[model samples]
Target: MIDEPEPRRQTPQELRGLVGSANIPTLLMVIYQVTRDERWLRPPYLPTRSKGLGDHDSGGLPEPVQEEIRAAGVRALLDLQDGRAPAIALPDPEQTRRMLEACVGEPVDRSYGEMFAREFRRRAGADDGPARPVRGGSDLRVLVIGAGVSGIIAAHRLERMGVSYLVVDKHDAPGGNWLDNRYPGAGVDTPSHLYSFSFAPRDWTQHFELRGELERYFADTFDRIGARPRTRFGTEVVRAEFDEGRQLWDVELRDSDGLRESISVNAIVSAVGILNRPFVPALPGLELFGGPSFHSSEWNDDLDVTGKRVAVIGSGASAMQIVPAIAPSVRGLTVFQRTPPWVAPFEKFQQPIDPGARYLLRTFPLYRTWYWLKLYWQFGDKVLDALRKDPDWPHPERAVNARNDGHREFFTQYIRDELAGREDLFGKVVPDYPPFGKRILLDNGWYRALCRPNVELVNEAVTSVVEGGVVSSSGAVHEADVLVWATGFTASRFVSSLEIIGRDGQSLREAWDDDDARAYLGVTVPGFPNLFLLGGPNSFPGSGSFMHFMEVQMRYVGRLLTCMFDLDIRAIDVRKDVFDEYAELVDRTSATTVWTHPGTDTFFRNSRGRLVFVSPFRNVEYWTRAQSAGLEDYEIVAAP
Candidate 1:
């Protein structure tokens, strides 16, 4: 008889995972974390610092060195998985600081290192940390508005602290903009790992998740927090007036059907995100259009675009996503642009996770944690230096500094490469302004889509709407069967949906001067007691993880509540001087940033050319301050 064929041997799962891609430095850290091995942090295994989105898989190391790290990583991880070693080992603060520096190949400030460690420990159950209710939190009642990401964040914090709170939204479910914007190819520009909650969020299917998935994530997040049972859906808080005698807010609620109701609560947290409202420009003859017209926010999913002539007005984020998705199906397409936006290379646009890598991210705790840290470092505070303006640098018209100019050149070349043969499309698409001056868009084949023969890129503002077409400012008629207003939102209008009456019957609109909104640390106003604003004036880090900042804001809110409990206070409003000083500081610092570049017009500024929205502070600074802005900054009312 012939010798029986030997059955094929299967590699261990952890070893199988090792063959897939990884951030080598992150993997080294993970190995050290898993095995508590000193060799991983030593000279031979240390990584050479690399930049951009490249995996730098071998970490610019010799092949032998990479082989050893990967092999050791797999073995260490298996030990953890098989219960031979501790499940999630961590370094001492000093060693962690050393590892952080060694891994990144740069000196990390102790302040930032401390902040990083705190975030690692506190971020939504990154470990088995206790969640103790704030002292006196059980007695407090909170009214959270807009059950979007921000509102849901508040609910999660409140529930953890054993605080009584209710969330309200006009939409029937938890999603805010994600619920509203269902246009084709709607997704986040931020990376999936860094864009999520720190407290053990689910592994994402894509590098950057799209609308439907994001919507589901929010709904699921709310459900997980046990928030839905306490949420009043299809309800809008139209008015809120401070009752001096009661020392509480009297809130007016309007349902989706226009039915009204009222309630009172100890505190109000406005989770109404910055981009909640859609702005449809009042173009002349829009009513005269024979074809159907709609804003990009209220996308009609049922309407078919196949074989139809479509005109998308406004070459912003929404238009970028919509045009590419529908361009293939539409017979003809016209994109009206007022100004071209700076487009960045979306490294993993539409890229799916590798199976083995996904398995590791899901199964290995240390692997997931280190991967998140890698993303945060790569995408976060690192970009700020390039964004800071160098006033002495020449050619301020084209770029901010050498680094900023390099970004512009890279983006310009990216546009050129995408539309190589079509040189005529260059002038129309390449921006003249400095990079980061406007909101930077992810490429995602937008330039290639614009190069399509059937698509037309009109380099002018939409001045009017005709019977069957949109009229450009140059009087050019772009004929179409359908019209889409992707003009973005009225971002300058903060909290416009609610008519808030603060101390002495002062309307919030009047306090904000109708358009210019200001809040102390972008959460509290001087006159609004027991009131907090999420994503309020200057809170945004311009570009970063929205979820991270939302958590920080709510955590700050938690600290404020703790302060109240400590002081035996009933209500606390930001002191007027404190608010004004913060505003002054913001204005002064913002003036020196690339965001304030006059060469580009952006929603980051208000009508008066004031930088009203974007936060000028570094991520670390904001994170640190949010943890402790102090009770001294507030004017408090004594508890009964």
Candidate 2:
């Protein structure tokens, strides 16, 4: 428990002011340093000062605890100040000194980013001396596969740097997943504002943007970023291999006309995300089913559901959204649930942003910053509190601590409230697991949809796909003409579908043995010189916005490429030891998060039951690691 402050207290307005005025500038400063965006500061209230117990007048922590908190905050701030994310569970001063050596590959008092930038600028010929204007040579040629968010970002970066690069997408147009998944209620869970690229900001029309809206946002962003001119639509990357002798990647491509062509690029950025391939579980009699059947990721538009019984398999995120959105239109919807998800009540999960609020955010920068800060705090920081272990809490079977237990209770209350006056449906809707044991879902009309007369939630796995319907493990059967498989992707298998061959005939699949998808700072792998991965393994923070992770990766990769160009280096690859050590640390940190809870079985873990999908560390910790790519972490090769 925190120590009391002699019963002294401030007025309500004063307290309000304290909460409102708390360290927003500091938070803004950190965000600005990382994103280099002046607009983030427009948020009114600062959350940093309030986040720490020391700033609260009602209580004060013990001196030692306070010192630790201060140290952690300082480390996080310093990391941001240096363009890196903060480190989690920062080591004490002595341990810090030791880790510093590992980070820099040598003992240096300065931070990792400072050392990196110093080396980078010196190599780029951008250091102190007067600029000798050398004659410009051919523009850097980069080939980006998959014109999705990452591809668009890569193209934008290349355009901004005046480097020539072409974006090739297999789809008819851009917006990778947005284009691919047109299922009912397909939308982004993360706020559209924060979900978008930091370089390109947009005033999203709705809080919960539908697929079309998100696609439009992407198109607008692509146009604004000047990527549209360089995009090759309906083009696909068949094979990409590194030419060790030439130090360039030879990419085989297929255009719309079925003509094969090859392109040589100085560098290749694989922006094709983890959800590249749609997976279908092998069930007996799957081929015998004559009705319309498709994966949720590949929703079919030709099939109508207005007066048909539908059986939706898999109770994942997509399943939840699809069931609710399509329930009204379907004659009857039977949802197959393998495991029930924990639902958290969000007041505005399905509500549209008020026009006034939108006006303020779009017109007034301060309001927008304030709004973002609120989201950053609620969505990112508060969860850390519940993760702390409680020694006195007896019910470890439910949650790890009092905070966690409290969260469970609050969520349980929400479920009960949603099911008020309908006790019959309560048994069906209530989840058996603790809150966050599974990926906590926001109430987006899920309960209301389930309450409908035509919708039935089945809690059994499908045993077989029969001619007219699917049979469950319990011997029960549900008849349906249309079956939508909402079963999720093979998340643990990073870069699973990509046919990438590296040095000495080494395949990316064989290199990792189909399990270990390790990368140095989740960007580059050994023997895959000049190839950068955007959203690689162990890079995703389990509880935060993926855009935050993407931003970190983009900045880190950008810095590394900048360093290579500056140093006249032709290739940079992660050292094996560095990659292993980082992966080991990721595994260690993941052990403590709820993702590792024994009762939970999430896609975050691989078939080996190893936590591989969601990163276990704090977002700040990732920010620290990705902000600067340590030279010692990689091996550099000069132009041959």
| TM-score of every model versus the real structure | 0.94, 0.78
Q: Which stretches of candidate 1 lie over 4 Å from their true place?
A: 1-14, 17-19, 35-39, 42-44, 53-64, 84-88, 92-98, 102-107, 123-130, 638-640
Name the 10 consecutive residues with the lowest summed lDDT in model 2: 51-60
Please list all clashing residue pairs in model 1, or write none if there are none: 124-199
| lDDT of predicted model 1 | 0.81
Distance from true position, residue 170, model 2, in Å? 0.8
Q: How many clashing residue pairs are found in candidate 2?
A: 9
**Model 1: number of clashes?**
1
C-alpha lDDT (0 to 100) for residue 32 of candidate 2: 39
The reply for model 2, stretches above 4 Å from the true place, is: 1-138, 384-393, 421-425, 638-640
